[model samples]
Target chain A: MTSSFLWTLRSFKHFVNGSSICQAGPVEKRGRGRRPAAQVRGEILDAAGKLLLDEGMGAFTIERVAAEAGASKTTIYKWWASKGALALDGYFHAVESTLAFPDTGDIERDLLTQIRAFARLLTRTRAGRVIAELIGQAQTDEDLAAALLEHYSGPRRQLAVAAMERARERGELAAGVDFEVVVDQLWGACYHRLLLPNLPITEKFATSLVRNVLRGIRA
Target chain B: MTSSFLWTLRSFKHFVNGSSICQAGPVEKRGRGRRPAAQVRGEILDAAGKLLLDEGMGAFTIERVAAEAGASKTTIYKWWASKGALALDGYFHAVESTLAFPDTGDIERDLLTQIRAFARLLTRTRAGRVIAELIGQAQTDEDLAAALLEHYSGPRRQLAVAAMERARERGELAAGVDFEVVVDQLWGACYHRLLLPNLPITEKFATSLVRNVLRGIRA
Candidate 1:
């Protein structure tokens, strides 16, 4: 159900461009003289991203976003039901280009490479703070929490799961190893370090982490 | 340095009670009569905790807390330097009684017991949401982040470290076991489950977690 919600949101962009007609059957425009829906959505996301990056969560109000985007409240609401949805949309839009999972033959090597890259993305870039803010605020906001689980966290987790399954099939994992638990420890340590700021999530840290967990679960 | 800061805060209560005279050596009052400093501090913490619990972070402003506590902003600032410090204080004040690290002879059992209790505190109680808010806001507020590490996370981590060191001394752990890494994997997994909310962090999950990590590191 949560995954479907995320899928609907992703497909919304396609639907807006008249490429898909599954849910809500696209938005109807008032006049033919209006700008393209995609352009408007892009502007909104651009404004939202800038607001989040520049000012953090304190300035991420819908009213301010609308003002920044030069769009009306009705126009923004026509696409996103809440501020959380819009913020998540802004997040996915910002990171989709760089968010890739590795699939090298060696699961350990692949995991280490990917985790190191992700650690940098999470700690070195603005995306890290932005993502942490969304995660933090997601605690109190149910809609945001659901949206984050569905859109942001779900896809990445699915990739990790698939990779673990492939490793298991190749007899690379210990007997009775739970891929879910493996992924949790791998990704969880990264997030914990990011949020708690007690440890540095460096490439060395990532390598040692992958080595430790792999040693624990290796066949 | 942060540990010292936490110690200072803890001693603040004693200083306010006219029982200890270290550091600043107590506050000097003006005029003839005044309320007990300890009671005033308690009132402030009570008001802050209530605001954080009842309304969440949106309403947890120093101005509002002062109004709720019927104390001046100056009075609140005299003890706490910022909102983050105050919020963490409130969290510690509220949960100090319930949060205890287990030290059973078996490291695995002790870890599972303590982690399960912590997972519950993070998910089943108001403390979960309160903590999430602090972590969320801590992303942008550096002061709050430091206080959280020093006051809330530091002591618990020390307890876990001590327990692991004891285990290693007993030869219950593998040679060259890194207790820091072990604690990270243990607590990080729980925090990951808490923040992502993708999986339920139950007792069974904790059991499996402790067993798996112990399998890797046990002698």
Candidate 2:
């Protein structure tokens, strides 16, 4: 077998091993061999994400994703039940690994660190805009909206709340303070910045927000 | 001339006297009577807002809105420069008259009152979903986004901040507290709740949010 064929065979084996479907390989030679399923899946997701970012969410369609990814429609449908699900998966996966909460044990430091990191990621990435658009689309498209809330918003809010709870346990929060509301306040700033687009979410803003929340909540 | 025509004549005289566009009157009985410009304008705006709420931002078009409103396309073009402009005007005018800052004079009570009122409005109106969708579209559509921020977010933020400042001036807020951050935190909670559909913005949630922020910020 040719080198490209051998490479495709190896990648396919890795995919079957349940590795992430995004591992890149040497470009396949024409007529050399079939592309690996994993490679094809990654291409589709990449194309979908690009289309979402470049053309807005309205441009994301199964046919377009298939054409751009050089994959068959059947291939994509086999993985995702619907186009919105695929779009959500593609959008979520792209940013999933980056969702981190700080645990510096200093409530002020931790909150500021987390907020700034999130702000930077959101403002800097094409994925950020795509996610925002998807959330907006969810308002009208019930299925997409439900999937987003379940897969995206629920987890993120839980994470933030958990962080606040940890701070409360550490006595960083004042007695009788509501952890849920504190989390909302932190998250609300981020959402307002994203949705409003008036103020730049600068480091200063993030730092001040963390400090203010801590000062207000600290026992 | 029919009574409708006479009525149109009287309405046009009234509009001229009031220095407003002569746009309202009964439709010409035989399709040859003068239609008041202001009536046509209001009809167009009403149609545009309805379309935006029902069909998402993409369905907004001069021709479509004119047809839906029973006005001519020429009439629409004469009023607004573009579809985005028309949509913007429709959205702003729909919500503008209802806008107000809570002035209960107590910071916590006022903030909570304002949030509760807004939450009720958002949940009650079809326009709420349309506004959310427009904000999303604005992220990609530069002009729409700019208009939204300038006309909507800017004023809203200003109102919130002003309320906080008033609280500080009245000694309801802790000395040296970062007022801007406090505003961001509160505003962020409401915006996040709107965008993220997982957490229902129930009255309890709104009340709890206010209570927590007040607890955190109170001297």
Write one digit per residue (lDDT tens) for candidate 2, span B9-123: 2233232234233345334211456556666677677777767656656566778887787777766666565565566566656565445776777887787777777777677
As for model 1, its CA RMSD to the true structure in angstroms is 10.0
Worst 10 residues of 1 chain B by lDDT: B19-28
Number of clashes in model 1? 0
Q: Where does model 1 exceed 4 Å of error?
A: A1-97, A217-219, B1-97, B216-219
- Residue A141 error for model 2, in Å? 2.4
Question: For candidate 2, lDDT tens digit of each residue in A1-219?
Answer: 122222232233233234334454433222446777666677777887667545655567889988888777877777665665566556655555455776888777777777777777677765566556555555545655565566567788788878777777887676666666666787667777776778876778777776666555222
Where is model 2 more than 4 Å wrong at Cα?
Answer: A1-94, A174-178, A217-219, B1-94, B174-180, B217-219
The local lDDT score (0 to 100) that residue A38 gets in candidate 1 is 70
The C-alpha TM-scores of every prediction are 0.63, 0.62
Per-residue lDDT for B87 in model 1?
A: 62
lDDT (10s digit) by residue, model 1, range A99-194? 577777677777887788887777666677666766776665676677667656777788888887777677666667666776677778888888
Candidate 1: tens digits of C-alpha lDDT, residues B60-154:
78898888777788878777766756765665765664557667777777787787877777766667766666676666567667767776677
Per-candidate local distance difference test: 0.67, 0.63
lDDT comparing candidate 2 with the true structure: 0.63
